[model samples]
Target chain A: MANVLIYANQQGGNLSSNAREALAFGSSLARSANGETAAVLIGPGAGTAAKEAIAFGAEKAYTIDSPLLAQYQVELYLDAISEAFEKSQSTILVLPFDRKGKDLIGRLATRSSASALTEVIDFKVEEGTVHYVRPIYGDKAYGEYTINRKKAVIGIRPKSHEPASRDENRTGDIIPLKIDLSEEVIVSTLAEKIESALSGVRLEDARIIVSGGRGLGGPEGFDELEALANVLGGAVGASRAACDAGWVPTSFQVGQTGAVVAPDLYIAVGISGASQHLSGITNAKTVVAINHDSEAPIFKRANLGVVADYMSVIPALTKALKKRMGVNTG
Target chain B: MHIVVCLKQVLDPELPPRYFKIDPETNRPDDGVADMVMDSYAENALETAIQLRDKIGGATVTALCLGDEDSEDVLRRALSFTADRAVRVWEDEWENLDGQAVGHILARTIQSFGGADLVLTGYQASDIEEGLVGPVLAEELGIPCVTLASELAVEGSILKATCEAENGYQVIDVPSPAVFTIVSSEKNVPRLPKVKDIRLSRSKPIEELEADDLEIDAERCQPAVALRKVYVPDREVACEFLVGEDGPELASGLAGKLMELKVL
Candidate 1:
């Protein structure tokens, strides 16, 4: 049987949301292959994460507990996970398409002499063969690929698949694997971590995002967006133009070359929606554009187009939202 | 110290969506856009390498790319932008190679260079967005790799890199003889080639390496993933312009629409 193994990625001792999606995809693939689904959780509190993976439809879970694997050091994690993968003897490996997973899948595939497909948005199994679908040419086109190798590693994009509902009564075996990590191989060491200015919700996780562009005039313009985001309980993002103009950090830039986010609501202020920028937000459920230029390209892609100056419109919109949501404007 | 930056040339990603067209028979994008440029993130990686060479005296920056003859343009562009040497690995058969095959070829190419103290690549190529080369190359070379690094500095045999993490930016320090995948940042905005330098870059010879010369096994270089089909997705949403004469009116209209959508 072609066992499918999903890497249940964890952060700060908690299971990541992406891990659930990967597990769900793995479960479906395993069922099609007439095999079993397993999860490999490598980090602290792997035991707890394994239990959670079982609730998400995994038949078995492997936990590699180690102190050195606490932080996301590539070498250490790869060593630990590769060991778990061998233990499971799975033919198909599913991973998340985030920064860490993107970095790991390729290396793991190479080490195991397997084939790999990255950033897969969907998949299908026909006659026991799997086809992975992904976006190409900056999301201008979608392409489906089928791996020819005996083993295949696939990285699934976040939010592409619906996560399977958790079943508290579901039970599975948690297998613990021991790893001996050496300090000599730890060439890369984390020196410091600087938290981003806006903390509560990450742009990817935020339901609503208030994004600004060059028309915001300067860095000061982001303050209004932050206020709107706060009122809406969301996050603030910036166009590449704004980030390149030094109005905001590159981390806040949302475009093809920057962070690709899909929120429920994306409000673009003073932004001319360039195709590159639109690719990142195409997955957003509802896009609202507020631009002074009536013919800005962004209006074609937005769900709601408001032709006006954002300086006058953003504050007004924030106030209206506060009043409608019954949030006090103190 | 010798630093090698792997570069890939791709169609300009900023091309308007309406202009993009895919050929059904070939299952590939039509080469309609005239301007083919270096991948933005690769430019960032090249910029990072150039900056490291500037910061540490006597460092050599070599740019490597694996593509068709048209890919030479980007190599020359890299030379004009301050890369000291350029190498292109191309063969007609390479057209069908997957990311894994490409990674093996790159690792072999780096090994043929005697060895490099550092290697850099873009976080992901804009075309296929596979992002498999850097880490896989590092694995083949048996070196550590740091991905999505925005800032990098070299001091003696130690390399320091700052990368964006889930919560924030994480600063990591690694020993030399490693690989880093650079992400675009303000500090790494590529410098435009000067007119004089652009003219001089023509004379800068780009060393070409064939797949045969690299002693690659033809069978091993076969693509691991086969492309089944390519097509454009249908537009799902039709934009609706809000009917309002003023700012407050527009704000209220948007708020009302949000309520109607049950998202408020």
Candidate 2:
């Protein structure tokens, strides 16, 4: 049986959601292949994290507790994880697909000379050979890839799979490893500066999104959408056209070249739904469109459509929502 | 400082895929193989890094890849374009691996190179468009990561980058020895590889590394996602016809039809 090692990144002594996803994925693969899954946590006060990882499905948990591991330092992490992987003789490596995961995978692949793959959406293991499926061509095509190595590392995209359930009764051993990292290779961290944090949740993670387009007029119009979004407990999104017009940030754009969102509720306000834009939000559970033009493409995709100017309807909706929710703007 | 930009050759997008192909008996244009070219976004990212190195001095740009030896042609082209050096971690088997696994091995190789102050990568590989490598590599390295970077400036030890965020441009100040994933921007447009530079690049170098040489878990790199099948989308648009008295009437009717379809 192959030994699988999953890096369980401890975020404030808890397992990151992405890490759980990796654990669930690795565990399922291990169970099917009769392999063993080991979770490795590297950071200060990661002992709890190591144990929690096991509770979530790992057979064993590895912990590397050091001052250098406290903050994310690229070189130090590479050194530590590489050392851990080397010592464990792990055959399969797993990590959450995120910033830290991305950095480690490429550099680790280079240093370790292992085969690697990224952003795979599905997988199957047959006779010990693993084949992966990923979308290509703007998700218009799906490609299958088979890896020909006994050992390899993969980063799992977040929210792609359900996380393994945590069993409180389950427990595992924490094996601490020694890896030395000096400050010479370290550079800096987020602690060095204070960022101007946003007041609301990030658009990528929000459950609901109310987006606007060119018809919204200007940045000032976003205030109404923002108000409506706040009333609906959702985030705000924008079409590429609106973003290009400098009325909104490109990050809020939902389209072929922008972020893909699959929210529970997606509201298109005055936006002519273009194919490129629809591709990003097609996965939303429920789409509602409000536009003056009855022929707007967005209305076709929307489950519910109100053929009216969004400016007139949004304020009323917000007021109704606030009144119903007993929320006082004052 | 030495930097490396890994590029992939991909199908061109300007000429969209032709979905329906008439049988040879009918002589209809088949979905011609999408013409292949260097990924535009990656090339732009490479240009940005190269320009940064040129402006700051004391930086070298190396192009790396883990693709078929034929792809060596692509790397050579990248060298001819802007990279100072080229290295192909040639492996015929890698053609099937996912981007995440590829990134894992690349990280290892980069780690072996040692002491790279900054690692620059494209926001996403055009072929897979996973947009995960730069972030995942950053996590693996435990370093600060700035992705979707539109503008970047390196001042002493700090890497100040302007990234496209949800609200407005976010100016991120990260300490050097960092990694950034570059997106396409006007500033990143690549100039043609000078004819003399192309000649010089041939003499530069192309080193090869075997996947087995890195010595990490051979199986850990297995893919998470598996593609079960690939079939072309059915060409099934029901064209709605609208008849009217005149141009405006016809336009309004078409608009009404669009409204009926809910696509304006």
Candidate 3:
């Protein structure tokens, strides 16, 4: 039977949602493969995360607790994870494709001498091989990859799979592992910065996104866009031009090189859709473009186009949305 | 600090699919478009390394890439970006090696190059997006690795970096002679080469190392992974449209049209 290992972590007694997603996905794969699922969690109070993973579907949870892991250090974490993989005899390693996930995949692939597939949207088992489909060329196309080796690893894309509901009756094994600190050497730590926004949903998870572009003119035009987004209960996004001009943080930019979003409703304000920008949100179920430029490229891909100035359309739209949905616009 | 940035030449995605064909057997394209250019994120990583070199004042940047013989074009482009030297790993069937195998081969090459204080790469390859080469190489070399790094600074053996995390951002402290797969950003965008630089790049040394030349396990040479197939995805957007006029004329009628389409 295949042994699937999940590399999970927690700090400050908190586990990331993506980690939960990884456990759920890995559990499903192991169940289907007639195998056992193991989770390797590092840090203090990571036991809470391990318990949560068990409740979801882990056959066993491996904890490597150490105060040194309170902050992420590459060497310490990798050494611990590599040991876990060796000990568990994990043939299939599943991890998230986020920052830590990406790093772990690389290190594990080398240490195990196994092939890796990153950004996998879904997977299927064929004979003894695991076939995975992933986006390539900045999500412009999809590729199907299969691993021929017995030991294989995959990085699951965020939100690609539905999360498993908590099952109180579900129970699994918990194993504790040792963490070695001698290998870890001090390099640099990210200066902790206060979070500016903690209440709103992340841009990737938002169901609706209202974005502004170059046509918004200056930074001031984004105020109206934000108002509309707030009314719609959506996050605000920006085109490359807007981000380049300092209209918004680079994190909010949607393009081939930026964030790839598939929101349910994408409203573009004063944005002329450049092909590069369209590459990011082309997956949106319904796209509405509001721009003064009648011949704008955004109009070509937009399901609905409004040829009006943002100053007039956005405020009116926001008010109408607020009245209809009773959403807090303040 | 000598930094080596490994690059690849890929079929530009914007180009129509008619110009390309994904080989069903190998899962990679077999079309004849080898205009070599560095991958976008690798370019960013190269830019970041160049900036670090400028600040530190004692580092040499080497551009190393593996592909068909035509990959020299990509090597030259990297050289034009002010890399001290360029090397193109030569292979007749280079496309057969998977990401992990590529990393193993690169690790051997890095050892031959005297092992740099730091190595940089793109977070994901545009063609495969496997993103294994950089990390696997670092592992094989027994060094630390950081991926998806947006900001980085190396002082002595310390690598202080900020990488893109799932919820927000993560600060990582890793020791160097490390490897980092850089995220795509315009922050440290690569600059276009001047005429003189381009001319000089043509004369830059291009070393060719064969995959067979590296002493690696024969099993690793074969890909542990295989590609089943590649197909065009189902088009989600309907091409059907409504005929309309400009501005006020359309604005008055827009709401009704949206309602008819059930888009309002």
Candidate 4:
């Protein structure tokens, strides 16, 4: 039987949603293979995370805890995960396709001589073989891949799968593994982590995103978008034009050359819908475009199209949202 | 200081969706469109190396690529941006190699070129978006690897970089002889080559390295994964346009729709 291993990623001492999704997917794979599903939690408080993983579908959880892992150093975490992976003896390994996971998946696959796939949107096991599906050409098409190797490492795209619900009544075995880690491998050390000034939700994780484009005129225009985003209890994004115009940081850019987001609701304000920009948000459930130009390309893709001056439209919309949500502006 | 930047030429990602077509037989995009350019993130990586070379005098930036003769266009473009050297590694059998095989080839190519103090690559290719080569190459070379680096600076043998994280940015310091996968940043915009420099780059010699020259293990260069099929995704949901007399009415109607959808 082919054992499946899922890396349970945690942040701020809590299990990440992506980790839960991986566990769910791993469990499905295990069921199909008639094997076992194991989870590996690496960091300071792995024991607590392991229990959480068990509730979320893991049959066994491996905890690799060490003081050196208090902060995320790539080398240390890589070594710990690698050792845990070996102990699990799994044929298939799953991880979140985020920043941290992306950094490690390729290296781990190379070291283990395993086939690897990233940003996997879906997967299926057919006749005891695993097939992975991923986006290509900036979401213009989809490619289905099959690994020929004995082992495979797959990185699941974040928010692509719904997380499995936690069951407190469920219980599983917790295994603690010990491996000798050398400090010499620690070539890179994180100097500091600067928090973003915008304090609601992360752009990638936000259920709703209010984005502004060049029609906002300048940097000051983002403030209005911010107000709308804040009122909606969501995140703010910007078009490439806005970022290039110095209206917002590149981090806020949502397009082909920027972050790909699939929020539940995406509100694009004063933005002409460019093909480059549309690639990032096509997966969004509902798109609302607010621009004065009636012939804007965004209207073709948006679920809601409003033709008006954003200067008057945005502030009024913000006020209406505040009223509907019953939030005090004061 | 010796720095190596890996480049890949891909179909223009900004092309309209209507123009994109995948060949079912080949499991690849149709090369009908002549809009091929260097991957955006790779351009950032190249710019990062150039900036570092400018900051620390005497640093040599070598641009390396693995593809057919068409890939030389990007290498020449790299040279036009003042890269000290351009090398292309190619073979007829290498056309369908997966990311792991390509990574091994790159590592071998770097080794043949006397190795480098630092290696840089894009976070991912715009076409494949696999994001495997850099980290796999780093492992093949037995070096530390960092991904999603937006800003990078080298001080002596120490490398300091600012990387984008989920919540914010994290400044990282690593030793020399490391690999970095650069993410696009506004500050690291690629410099366009002047017409004179573009003409001059044609005269510069580009070294061609073949698979036989590297003497790589044939087994190691075999693709680990096989592409089963490629197809355009079907758009299942038709866009529904909301109608309203004005801005406030439109906002209210959209909000109501969200509530109905139970996403609010």
Instruction: Please report the candidate that would top TM-score against the real structure.
Output: 1
| Complex DockQ per candidate | 0.74, 0.15, 0.41, 0.65
Give one digit per residue, the lDDT tens place, for model 2 in B44-95: 6778778888878778987777676666767777878767777777556664
TM-score of 4: 0.93
What does the interface RMSD come to for each candidate? Answer: 1.6, 8.1, 3.9, 2.3
Best by DockQ: 1
Candidate 4, residues B43-98, lDDT tens digits: the string is: 98999999999998788999999989998899999999999999999999887888
Error of 4 at A330 (Å): 14
The true-versus-predicted C-alpha distance at residue B150 of model 3, in Å, is 3.0
Query: What lDDT is reached at residue B252 by model 3?
Result: 37
**TM-score, chain B only, every model?**
0.96, 0.82, 0.87, 0.95
Q: Calculate candidate 2's fnat.
A: 0.16
Rank order (by lDDT, best first): 1, 4, 3, 2
Error of 2 at B224 (Å): 14
Q: In model 1, how large is the Cα lDDT of residue A183? A: 63
How well is each residue in A104-199 modelled by candidate 4, as lDDT tens digits? 999989878899998888877777677788887877788889988998998987767879788988889999988898888887888878877767
Candidate 2 global TM-score: 0.68
Which portions of model 3 show Cα errors greater than 4 Å? A9-15, A178-188, A191-201, A213-221, A239-247, A254-262, A268-286, A289-316, A319-330, B16-26, B30-36, B154-159, B166-175, B212-214, B239-264
Order of the predicted models by TM-score, top scorer first: 1, 4, 3, 2
B1-264: candidate 1 lDDT, tens digit per residue: 999999999888777777889889888778777478999899989999998898887889999999999999999999998799999998886787777788889888998999799999998888898888888889888998898899998766788899888766889899989999998887998998899989888999999998767867565588889998898887646789888888899899988887677565
The Cα local distance difference test for each model comes to 0.86, 0.69, 0.73, 0.85
For model 3, name the residue pairs that clash.
none
